[model samples]
Target: MEAPPVTSMPVTGGAVNMMEYLLQGSVLDQALESLLHRLRGLSDNMDPETFTDHELVYLLKGQQGNPFILRARRSLSHPTSPWHLRYLGQPEVGDKSRHALVRNCVDVAASHSLPEFLNEMGFRMDHEFTANGHIFRKGVMKIVVSKLSRILVPGNTENTERLSLSYLVELSVLAPAGQDTVSEDMRSFAEQLKPLVHLEKIDPSKQRH
Candidate 1:
């Protein structure tokens, strides 16, 4: 069976439920600098946060339903920081009234033993990659601009090749389940990035052939 639903996993010790509102787009390598400059001015005043992370996708197969998937990510630049484990459900794209795609999301901070723990729980590694990016925040909204690299040798994060000549951009906010207002904020922020990058609620499920 799948591990557990977001509501069951108490990452935050409360009765409230959380959901992830997301918008995604991409910027060509040449346009990255300008986008970064714009984001720096628009985002929070703290120093820019840049990161290098190695991420592994793990899957646990079941007799019925889609395979349970989990992402295990650890920072290469800040090795001392805790690893991040995230579970994101399928995006809800049918609601045209909403400005952003909403999905169930559970985030947990884990120790370096994350991989071993997942394996012990019968999860298999599906793929791995390295992401180098800058993170920005405006209120509860979080934005990430990242370039992905395909790991060449298994388990070797150092030996990787660029996946594309563009950087993937994501604007997201984790808020309580009923907060539709957060999508308005996301849409407004996306407008600020207009022409530079067109962020939209692209359904990943539809893209799968």
Candidate 2:
């Protein structure tokens, strides 16, 4: 089935300058259960929503070393939601705080034919993967426990293999620019997950080196 045409909505409060609060760490195979238990208690509701997503990361190479990244994702479980296209700009340098990294982000909603649209826009498929996870929400914060798998074949969502035994844990909150209080809330929630997984904001630039 073909989806509708792409549409964009104007975000309020200067979304272009929005700072994302994020904490990322890995959970060992043995500690997965303990982490889940702790999450269940901290989350608003008892049951967590499960989701499987197939994501394609596209890049436009430039003369400089840095490349522009565009991510397109579709939900495997919910067919109703439109495909999402997201661009998260390179993180700013010199800020090593665990609170969060500030970056420019643009999000667009498009039909399933987004791949063709991306190619038309000069983006090449760099890599693709599948992530299965459980999402827990607390106020404005979103916590996800995800396991990534490598896509065995391009454009074939079904063909995949587990990338690793450890699960990737992420804590993030998307808020309008200038909302400094969100960072403190994110840090407090992160502390609750302590020894099971140490969640800290990782520098994307440093990770590349």
Judging by lDDT against the true structure, name the best candidate.
Answer: 1
In order of appearance, the predictions have TM-scores of 0.92, 0.85
Per-residue alpha-carbon lDDT of model 2 for 36-104, expressed as tens digits? 888989999857788999899999888899787889999988867899988775554344343765455
Residue-level lDDT of model 1, residues 41-141, one tens digit each, is 99999899999999999999988988999999999998999999998776677777889988888888999999999999999999999999999999999
Off by over 4 Å in 1: 1-15
Backbone clash total, candidate 1: 0
Deviation in Å, model 2, residue 39 alpha carbon? 0.8
Clashes of each: 0, 0
What is residue 77's positional error in candidate 2, in angstroms? 1.9
Please give the distance, in angstroms, between residue 155's alpha carbon in candidate 2 and its true position after superposition. 1.9
lDDT score, candidate 2: 0.79
